[model samples]
Target: MTTQTKVSICLPTCNRPDLIVECIESCLAQTHTNIEILIGDDSKDDRTQRMIATRYQHEPRIRYVRNTPSLGQARNVSSLFNRASGGRILLIHDDDYLAVDGVERLVSLWQRHPDLDVAFANQYEVDQAGHVDREASDRLNADFYRTKSAEGLQQPPGRTGLIQMFPNNGWMANADLVRRISYKEQYGMCCDYVFGVELCLAAKQVYYLNEYVSFYRKTDVSISMTTKRSTSAASVSAYAFIEKLRLDRPLEPARKLALRRIVPIVVSVYSRNHDPIKGLRIAAKNLFAYNYGFSMRLYYHLMMISRSMLTLKPR
Candidate 1:
């Protein structure tokens, strides 16, 4: 790639006009001059389009697309990739903003490793008011394997991504790799992770730059925030996709046990979503994964019964 390689910042938004403004500004503030910002507004109303028109109308670097009838979370993301004109694409969620030199640093890393298929870095988590949560950020980084000790190319990208979720904010990837990939509608809320895994496997060249390159806004509506209800089926389906994937022989067991070892908190949620028969079957299937003794299994059934009864009753 040339020193002046172009980058497309794909910012996908919905009705959150208030949040997206900072995202656009952050893209505009990138130190890399050869770039374009593509905003696919999936908002049901014209609020987002109006905001861009008024605030960034004169900005030639931005190309805004108001998706008709709203393309939904997964498709909206894919649409931005479809329109990207740069040799590389960096995706910045509407609710998140880049660190001023995010693009410059990631671009520099890619330039250094010209064959890099995907590259991503750490982020600082901030609340609605933009106050950084120092503790939560540290936990998140540790949870995702974003250790302060290591940075640079990953030897086996898929394994690193499965454990660390490298498709997160502050990511930049070859336009060709991303263009060949799409956020499958079937993946639903977990489409991004699924997409990232696909890129990791196909590319065979991925990098992890362990530096904070962006701010992840922790808004109430952001999916990271727990909701009043659980979408167990969606979560199950995405996990199924992961389970079915064929990776290098050594990585398969680690991949299967990855979610099991980490997401034990979801046991009750999964139980509540299924009928008693299915719930018990699930419990039996992953008894070892849960690592819960007989007492825990009994407790799971009781909780499932209570929640199931509650949901069956009319409001």
Candidate 2:
């Protein structure tokens, strides 16, 4: 008596011909039949295209697209939505493949809880050869998908709230929710983090599935772990979001205290990975804006102090 909910699995891949087939195959093999797979591949090499044409040419539900160069990940992802034709959308990265029954489980859960804006499942980490690694639990943070409301999301301002809320890997969102809240165009690596945070903050209900529905490939050369600007973009964007939050919402002293602790860590992680100059600049800007006040300023100063200490210390 219920209408079948359609799913659009959006994959934004870069030059992973070897991985592409498996990723698509896993999605195609979903226990849920009412699903469409959309690929927004930006591979400089055409191996992925060749593979799709030769091996996957028979699939009707699969659509593959080649993104023009230099569009970047966030923009490429935006384009994926345009190609989507399902009631719900799942943004699956190229290097990640879903579980055999992942889509079916998600659909069953969503049907039971239509009020939830976002739903995330557990994922495994594997090496290039597809050997699973149990120790790479860091790749899978299940807590982020924990049930949270907009009101309960407020915490004594710091990483505690952010980490507690966004402690996971891939997520499924209501297509309508995404269309209503735009992704920060400039966000590269951290776009997922920023997007997840924004969506969660605005969502009335969120769900966590404590089951591994995907395998996140853990290679030393993966873009996420690399020192690319995309990797550090989330920090800059989060600070920007904090400023917006400060203007839009008023929080208690506890929340403000948490913010103070969070800003420094943001800068510290940014500086260590990407541009120290940009990190310092953001810290100074936020501090002068009095976003979190003197304690946060002190925290950034402490990070610098520690760096200096390490520099001056004998190795």
Candidate 3:
């Protein structure tokens, strides 16, 4: 914690030694000189360890730790969170790479507003061959509400996160804030989402820069692509309670509007998993909570629920 700015790039990687090279290279290529790349490797084999040792052993800026017994994704991230040393920390997935100036840009954002607790920018979507998709990247930002209009300090930052703007990629936070909120296994796939909310809640000033700071790769091996994630009823209930207890009274309407947009997707995912009962349960809970009238959105959800019930796979 010197007067000089130093950023710790906490990267949690597993089994993808070949893919991680680009990520590491990008980190090393950063314009910011004061950075430590902490690589927490959870690979089953020693390939990643050998690769890092062979390429970066002499490098003072990099630290490599291979977990004796694999830490999985959540625990591995928790380990990185605890070991981070810089004033600010950026969490990078193994398959993703930062812009050459990513850390510098993010740090500069904080330097301008020294009291800012968390800062992040939009990201570009890249393919397996590292080709950036302009349209997909723009749509990604738009969908997440990372538009120019939404730039600047977001009050009650939890609402911005609750609405899905705070992503797992391309963000940096104060070391204390990141360490204060450890990863939770109970949230399942939604743990990252919940973590974002917790970080924003802990932060006094959270700013969204309208610039693209990193590349989010869309690979076949990605968690979202390789697996089907079902949002549990427990997760829905927990999110609802979080909104009720933590969100401001004026933000109630905003939360409801956000939930109105998200409920259909949650219900559809449950339906796809052939768990119509759970889907209906969530749908009914929301409908009853708001005493919703028969609007088109309500009708559409009702129809989706009705179709799912008829087509339910037997237990």
Candidate 4:
């Protein structure tokens, strides 16, 4: 008998007892039977534990581990990756959920393309009330499909194309690949983006499926939303990663140009957060060492100065 490929669905959750059950149920209802739902709960309260024990404890496929003290977001996710024992790994955040046959479809695709290292499908962006934002969903789908139709699936999307066709929550990859390219803990808010980029760069072939595999909840309390409200950590992380890529990796001219364009936008995020000093420092570093052209240097300098002036007192 042929051994079936086992998939480990790793869910790193916090204090979202209200939404976690739904996420868990969605995983449990997958059409693929050879799957394990590994939930690493970093919740401050025991609500998640209680809910899992009461509702899903009888299920043999569910394995729930509650960290004694919270492990922060990145570490918790890393822990899940470490604990996963299957041939394939799929990460589903506590607030997000898989479509009924999401895993089955992903597995089917993987079976067809045995050499693929990573696969991602389009996802629905839903509001706090779980209503799909059709406009945003349509736009995302169109962009993804257009890229796939133009590029074709046989060729792996290089760094530049991968950046343009950003993979959201509905991503899956070979288990060994994820273990080898573990999440970088230093990139707090931008870890996912960093992880995805690294995966795409390393993968021999990355596939994009047209199916809507998951629903990503866009709540005001989400990490990205909250980080945007308070600080420029995400931008800082992006800048750091971009610099790392520029310094470490040999990029084609197109990818190099894309990085040059992206640097200023990240700097602008810092400037908007009233962090002109850090932004200027980033701009200066990239300007002098990273070979960012005169236009970008001038733009960052002007933008920082304008932001500084705007924030100045009337006195």
Give the distance in Å from residue 304's predicted Cα in candidate 1 to where it truly belongs: 4.0
Model 4 lDDT per residue over 220-292, tens place: 8877876763354565576566665642244454355555655666666767777677667766666632464
Provide the lowest-lDDT 10-residue window in model 1.
225-234
Which lDDT value does model 2 have at 2? 19
**All models: lDDT?**
0.76, 0.65, 0.80, 0.75
Worst 10 residues of 4 by lDDT: 145-154
lDDT of 1: 0.76
User: Could you tell me the lDDT of residue 6 within candidate 1?
Assistant: 95
RMSD of 1: 3.1
Candidate 3 structure quality by residue, lDDT tens digits, 125-234: 99998899999999999988899999998877777766678878679999988988977776665567778877876788999999999999988766654544455543
Report the C-alpha lDDT of model 2 over 37-68, residue by residue, as the tens digit: 88887889888888888887888988888876
Candidate 1 lDDT over residue span 173-226, tens digit each: 999889898788877766777887777877768888888889988777766445
TM-score of 4: 0.84
**Top candidate when judged by lDDT against the true structure:** 3
Q: Which residue pairs collide in model 4, if any? A: none
TM-score of 1: 0.89
Candidate 1: misplaced stretches above 4 Å? 1-3, 223-228, 232-234, 261-266, 292-315
lDDT of 3: 0.80
